[model samples]
Target: MRLRNYLLTSIILLTSLPVLAQYGSQKKADNLFNKFSFVSAAQVYHNLIEKDFNADYATRQLADSYAFMRNPDSAVVYYKKVVEQPNVPIAYYYNYAQALRGVKAYKESRVWLKRYKKAGGEINDEKFLKDSDFINSIFNAKQQYFLTDVNFNSKYSDFGAYEHDGHIYFASSRNTGVSTKHIYGWNEEPFLDIYVTDKSVNDSIIDHKSKLKGDINTIYHEGPITITKDGKTIFFSRNNFSKNVLGKDEEGMTNLKIYKASLIEDEWTNIEELPFNSNDFSNGHPALNNDGTKLYFASNMPDGFGGTDIYYVDINNDGSFGKPQNLGNVVNTDKNERFPFINNEGVLFFSSDGHPGLGLLDIFGTVSDKDNNIISVLNLGVPVNSSKDDFSFFMNEDGLSGYFASNRNGGIGSDDIYAYDRIPQLKIEGTITDITTNTPVPNAMVTLLDSNNKEIARLETDDDGNYEINIDRDTDYIINIKKDNYIEDTRQVSSKGLENKVRSITADFNLNRIVKKVTPITELYPIYFDFNKFDIRRDGTVELDRIVNLMMNTYPSMIIKIESHTDSRGSSKYNDKLSLDRANATYKYLVDKGVDPNRITEYKGYGEQKLTNDCDDTMDCTEEQHQANRRTQFIVIKME
Candidate 1:
């Protein structure tokens, strides 16, 4: 009986060799594919197909290869074929469902998703629900969650991404650092360079095809670029090689420096070193404010939480900088927190590895004031993060879709940039008014236009003189409020900079009255200006141009008064003189811009006499409200 058992075991071992070999080859291919080596894995899987025509493992892996290559159609073909086989693992259906979702087969994705769950499949549930990739389809499918895999680069390790003016700037360690001079092993290259790319609306991404007409490329480690809204200024992280004679005995490396450059007439010059940067500590990841007047960044300097702390600096009027202020214990912890991003509305977003999250490093957003006080902080959670390190997130103008860099699983290479469209949460609202009565007009027609100024939605005002419209995030929209007897009022909302927040716009409409030459001072919105300034800033330009255009068209035969005011910052007599000069300057500029001088009336300045604030600079009053006391405005006094 013992001899018979031994014979049976030997026969079993001999028979299992072929099966074991086949499993080993498939496992190897899967491993290679997971590491982003699709070419080698595809070749191996191809060989397996030739050896065993009945093997389905190789077929699944081959589909994954096509998916890694971004050929979703071929991936779908193989994935669909795998589902037809009996007794396959539930992961096949789950993964195939994700692939189907990637190719935008919402109905089919729901079918496989339901099948996987029914077959007891479980993995990455949060990804299915939260990832912006399937947001549209998942909502359409009425499904809660789905499975997702990242697509990375096979040859290069991308670390950072910044979007501006229809182009993308990023840091990469691919096909570079061949020489020993710039050598850093494992994490990244010694000289991580910044590369620019033009991403089209289509799925095609082109590198170095942007119209960046300057020496943006540096020999040293020049990376992590943050461009301003106008694309005129750039703040980048760089490592400068300076001989450290006293700090080190011998063989010391260079110091890391953050540099600022301005684009002058399509060229980058006037490169200046930021004073807030310290030599002993590494200061990088500079995030610029919407107006480019402040910078939020990460530094390892003293008086931090422990590792790296987020800091801020104010750019002064004379182009100088103030002392760096550390963002306190709320937003930053005693960890290697870095990669700061500040939105236009002073919302701060960053990545932190030590924070409680679903991934190694999760992206977090916080609301902050000008004093660097963190009001609220929230982790982006599952969809925006993963088990691996996730960082370098940027939202586009519409806040819906943008590029983020990550080293997550199932990527094309080491680290690849992924463009994700955020699920939109938008609310459109307005009030309708009578053309002549100056009261609410019920049931007025309203049309919402998209970024290209195309009509997207329509609504009507309620009896309460209010209307609300819902929309997706990341959409450039225009609100066109029209009543039968009134002029069509069109307004625009720039959703490009608003990624994950609600935008409120008041679309107030006023119909043309039956009375001739309608001119109402109370009806016009109040215009505010800074102290001792005649030139309108960008924000002020929007409102000022509206008044200018109104006067030029509606009140063409009228004479207007340009009035200026000042706070009690100086002596009343001196303030009055300065205000008069500013008012005259504004008047001349308008005349030069083609506004008829005969239609222009008197220009007057009321310095300290017409002060808006009760307290002067010498009195016990805050400087903030005092700054608001100064102003420039116009009054249509007489009709020609």
Candidate 2:
């Protein structure tokens, strides 16, 4: 029997050709690929993928080869195919989104990224954000900003701009030197170096661009540079180096480091590398405040929040560096963050792929109030950001117009510098109040729902019953005000076609109280009659339903009185007659909907005699004010 079992195992192992190759060729391909031997690895992965189309390992590696090869068009083709397969890995959804964005398919990229976020556990095939909080996060999208590419962008990669003394300093790969022969394996663009352009005008016109006069532009990639207010001190990023020779890691690749250069007789001299830089990991994208007391940069160093978190170090008065401090989880995520820029107003702007965004890296801003204690981070929405990689944001000293970088669609090169101006604010503000008491209703929840009743934004009324919603442009919104024990109110507002016009709207809610908890003698809510109409409308039925449910379930033998009233517009005889019909109608509706008629002992019509608010013939009142007088109430007369 043991011999037979062994024979069966041997047969099974021998016949599983696909499984064997999946275990064999995939490992070889991955090993070769990790060594950056993309040419050989692609060939091996290609053969394996051809045999089994659903082989995720082979398919992923092959696509990654093209992605790392800076061939997004080819990568997207494979990724699109991979995402279509059943039981695909969730991470592949994100990868496919990135590939789509790289090819400038911005709209398509968002669909895949949303799918990636939805690719949760197997038990639930619906949206991953079935919970309330997640649903709220993606309820609204920002599409107000206007982004236009600056003309200074070269045919090569030109990005990361800094403005000083009427000259703009930025990094580019325009291939101005013989070093252009050496291309980075990733992205295949020429090694980046800083360039200064002395142009004054703001439009797309470009002129007077040249390399930095100093030795700042090196053979390897040199990244974003930051200058202090005095303009005498500068900190820039470059490849890890010792004595001008590029330093390589164990894998024979270069990492980034921060170096400080001092202005000596108009020449940037005395270059000293900051101490905390590691040979294995990277630290790049230096940004400084006006005084240069602290330096912020992005790094993949050990024990960080995740991939490439932003870190800050204190630059002491004597030029010594302090220990690096991670910016915490609020500012960092499990993915990459790069290109941090701090403006003069103490606002910290950075880029990240981990935060909720359009698709890829979207620029985010963090700011603090005067005490430097209040911190808030906001996503700088499109067109300043896109479904593509947008990073390295820098605002001018004036804090108005500035520049950022993006590999987004319609750019002239691989990464282009884009000049942007802040868009105007559009908003809606309101208050919720009780009509009878004429008092503000604090803690009232105001929800702004779309046409489908999906809440885009919600807030509670403050202590003064005030609520504000920063509405989006060209969208119709339904504002719902709800509070416990009060009738819910809804109003529809259209924001469409209000883009060019500066319009902020005011909306107010006056809710009638619905107190259904009868105290064996307490008065219930008013059943309002509309302009001499004696019929119970849908609003009146809602109150009647609540009363019916309470009396039947909570107070079975309780006796009650239904009183209906009309406004002071009609004669007393006419109003009293109309009010009686309304009271009868309310009672009939309750009896029809399974409410015990015996529980309703008597029905009365008070007309306008028992007005809740001060609105009479002598008092000047609008239709809305007069609505308070026209109401219905149910009083519990006796208990079992």
Candidate 3:
């Protein structure tokens, strides 16, 4: 978990694995990697593997280097080679999963993440593993938003689109751009610059795009702009390479800085760097407060909480800037916290690789208290944020619809800008308990079915017998509850007929025991065994599962006696054996399905002694009537 010591560990690994002179290249790579210069380190490690020296270990490190370097495409390539290998480091599973996500391989990512959670020891974060399942659940949960790629997106990487009034401004690395043709080492993509395009009309997007005019679109990376409501002042992120005054960090790489400029005479003028801009660390992704009194941005500056922290600064009345304050650990983790976007309601939306998520960086939202401290953070869930690099979330003035960036699968570009709008929301919940005892039935299956009787959501009850699921606003739903040994229960709970508002209601399921007070309820569902076979049929198992639930959970104190009956068509001795075999097979099935074996007091064949209808050999009865005579029934004999 402590990555600062990785350099020492890598150095020791290199020296012990091979002769110093033979693996000097690896040592150099280790040193570079220790300094967090992952791009160059990945190259060295890659070359070492190509030369057939330490290929196994280099494969893992190389993948990690690419991952730390923010080059998911390359990381995915190398990580796949070492992810399933034995004796590999545990962290590789997590990194491999994230790399897969960065490439929008969510299912594959989930497989590796499962491995990561299994391998978790000292690096265990239980919530992280739990949230992984939640990520999958979010797919079937209430979906209130839709996404589509805009037409102006480039084949390279086009994202971070924000709209002001009518026109939309964004960042792009289109090859057609002017000035610098430099390609960034990370991801091997062209440098980014600010670009402007008209907002899509009626969901119709166009390819009309051009670089933002003036010195703002410099040789270095730029864009992710936010404008004041007045449209007079604008803040944008750019590398400190403009005007030949490049500011590099300790790694000799240029750091990003926030710049402010004014719109005057039909052009951006008074371009000045923000006072908080530093050469030692990167700062970018500026978001202005609704009233322009505060500025929120991401930075890796000194004394910061993480790789990047969302910080806000005050704008004094005299136009002076206030001290930058960290948004704190609740929102900023040791991993990354980037792309801070504050909505009209003062809720902060940011992208984070630090929080519990599907994979890679996920969009998260948090609201601040009066002191600017984070109160709570929620993963934007799914669709709004996929299992990839979903960041740069922006909300239009409408607050219900907006745009964001995602490198998820099916994107036309490495990263594409997508427009989205909120769907509707409905919350449904209930409790599952026993009808006889009125006791909570923990871990009971609570399934939500649509009007068509198709299962839409399946959840389990907690210790308190509580379960919840989200649905669309105003929809009819059937809630089904099932637990071992208990009779299945189904209840109808409708969000329909409700007005435009959130609704929460409890729909408790009281399950009765299949064997109730010395009576065998053959009225529930009939179970019949085929001739010469004792195996439980599909329909039999369905009926038996409830019996198993009733005996094991709902009425553990009741002793059950299962009697198997047969039609008169079979011989007396043969019928007796056949019926007994049927009873025993059913008995084994209940036990195998988690019912207590001791709960079954007696199980025997009645042969033709107990017929439900006139299906004897001498009688003219239909096959259906004969089948009804051959049935399995359970009776409650005694209570413990």
Better of 1 and 2 by TM-score: 2
Estimate candidate 2's alpha-carbon lDDT, on a 0 to 1 scale: 0.70
Q: Local error of candidate 3 at 174, Å? A: 0.5
Question: How well is each residue in 1-640 modelled by candidate 2, as lDDT tens digits?
Answer: 0000000000000011122344356545544443334556678878876786325445666776666544568888887777775444455676676677676787887787788767651223234222222211221122334555576787788888999888898988777545336577788877888877766765443422376666666778886899888888888999886576888889997899998888888777777889998889999999996678999999999898779999899989997989998888868889998888877655678999998777799988763432553144456766777899999998766444689988888878898998875433345777788764458999898877766676555567878888765554445668898999788988887655543334355678887667454455455676666776887878887878878877788777666778888888778899889888888888888899988766676788888888777777778888888877777787765544
For model 3, give the 10-residue run with minimal summed lDDT.
1-10
lDDT of 1: 0.62
Q: Write the per-residue lDDT of candidate 1 for residues 280-354, one digit (tens) a residue.
A: 777888888778888878888888898888888998889788999888887788897888987654567788876
Pitting candidate 1 against candidate 3, the one with the higher lDDT is 3
lDDT of each: 0.62, 0.70, 0.71
Q: Which residue pairs of candidate 3 clash? A: 144-423, 484-549, 485-548, 485-549, 485-550, 486-549, 486-550
> lDDT by residue for model 3 over 152-228, one digit each (tens)?
77688888888887888888887662443788888888888787766655433433236676667766689789999
- Model 1 residue 147 CA deviation (Å) reads 12
TM-score of 1: 0.44
